[model samples]
Target: MGAGQSKAESDEHFSEEVVNNLSDNLASPDTPPERQSSLDAHIRSRIQVELARLREEEEHVREEIERALEKENLDRERDMAGDETDSGVGQVKSTTALLGDVDELRKQVERFHSKKDDDDFVAARLKSEAVVQCYKNNPSTTLDCWKQVDEFKASVAHLEERYVESLR
Candidate 1:
């Protein structure tokens, strides 16, 4: 701007010549030497701020890398253990799961008979999850919602008594 400066050159990396020229363009040449030195200091401070921001970014990236490496190591260890146990990495099948990998690896489950829904039905007065959720969601006044809870418990107990009588 002072002479033949373009927008592109102004955006280039800060150098002594560029910084002085930039300062001179912004301030009159009649500015005192002290003011010029202050401008230089301001430019240096800006550079330091940028450097500090870059260092912090680098530190964050390093922490992420370390976490990733740690996870990878743990995964490798699990894979090694699985290989020894003949499961192989992510292929560790549960004893109850449907696995066709025999040499008869799983000897316990002779059949996959699922239990009847009646077996899961409770006749006893038990707190259902929804009732517990009411207490959890409204911890300050659980006594306020006791009516609904009582109804639910009574309903379950009635169902359970019927189920027991049928069983007998």
Candidate 2:
């Protein structure tokens, strides 16, 4: 047989020997009835104590496991929220850049129209009107971008506050 199998067999034999010894001691006819009852009660009390200790240990382990799971869940949620905030900031940056480009384009178009003859006046006016309409449609877009950046900053501040509170 393998070494592992031999070791297992030995362990089983040891356990059986221990059980036999315990049974023989408990069943000895030389033991007085009152003494035997007292011994039994003492054994019962010891078993109850051991059981209570084991139950307490089990409860402690369960509480630790639950705390770890809750911490992991909170960390996952925090990471997801951070990713969403980053995506929002990226979008806001892109929109801000596009607005800047549009403003530059409008300026260039105006310069070109100013240098042109009266014949181009109608086309230049139409282009300028279109630009004006675009600005009018979303007058608060730039303001909104600024607000988003501010809000992002505020969120960081709030997180710091919460972290400090937790430490306390």
Candidate 3:
């Protein structure tokens, strides 16, 4: 036969086989009334057992979910604590660096003040020598200049005392 004819014949055969199987199943004998009732009771008992097992499985799944959520919460709390600790450490490091900078600035100021004091001392000594030389040349004019020089020297001594006190 041609391929198209053979294919149509196979489709018809398959439909006939399905119809025969359905008719055979439907024509099977029915059970007696007492036997049918007993069979139904057995089926109901099995159904109750299956339902109990399914409920137990569901409860176990719920317990597992609760445990997983508790573990996740613990991990989140730990991560937050670690973050807080890291922030505290960063703050301490920043504070230490700032304090170090302040100490260096104080040292620089002290050095500047020391240099200024040395320059003032040298200038005062030179002025005192010049006044003495002028008195040796002109005694009357030198006398007034000498008095002014003495007053200036006393004020400088007072300023030096205050500077030393500040150092302490």
Candidate 4:
């Protein structure tokens, strides 16, 4: 087997040398007609064989790449479909929970407003409204509303003191 392989390799090398020599000889004016035509045919056949092999290799690589891309696209589509179903369920649950939370907040705000009728809150609120009215009535004489502003500040301070004492 080794001897046969070496013989084949040597024959290939010899063929290349003959081809090179024949090409050079064919280019000169004194070449024989029969030998020139035969060398030219051999060289052309070798080139055609090599080109066919290269085209086959390129086609094989192209097929492999196309198959890989197709598999990737299928996997991506499957993942997206799964995510859509999961997200749809999650969104429904989250939306209902959010609505319940919003309703609780609205009830809290209503209760706070109802409690605003208490005596101290009403007094502070009334004083604040008076200060706003005074400022509106005397826009150019802002200093004139000092008495109303002072009364509002005193009411707010009293409310703060009561809140701190309740905390203690």
* TM-scores of all predicted structures: 0.34, 0.36, 0.36, 0.36
User: Candidate 1 vs candidate 4: which has greater lDDT?
Assistant: 4
Report the Cα lDDT for candidate 2.
0.71
**TM-score of the candidate numbered 4?**
0.36
TM-score between model 1 and native: 0.34
Give the RMSD in angstroms, all C-alphas superposed, for model 4: 17.5
Q: Give the TM-score of candidate 2.
A: 0.36
> What is candidate 4's lDDT per residue for 59-85, written digit by digit as tens?
999999999998987787667667777
How many residue pairs of model 4 clash at the backbone? Answer: 0
Q: List the residue pairs that clash in candidate 1.
A: 123-160
Off by over 4 Å in 2: 1-28, 88-168
Whole-structure CA lDDT of model 1: 0.69
In order, what lDDT does every prediction score? Answer: 0.69, 0.71, 0.78, 0.86
lDDT of 4 at 65: 100
| Candidate 3 residue lDDT tens string, 23-132 | 88678766688988999999999999999999999999999999999999778766766787787853222345669999999998998668666866667666667667
> Candidate 1 lDDT, tens digit per residue, 29-114?
68789988999999999999999999999999999999999999778866766786785335655433435555344432332122
True-structure RMSD, every candidate: 18.3, 25.2, 24.9, 17.5
Which residue pairs clash within candidate 3?
none
The RMSD (Cα, Å) of candidate 2 is 25.2
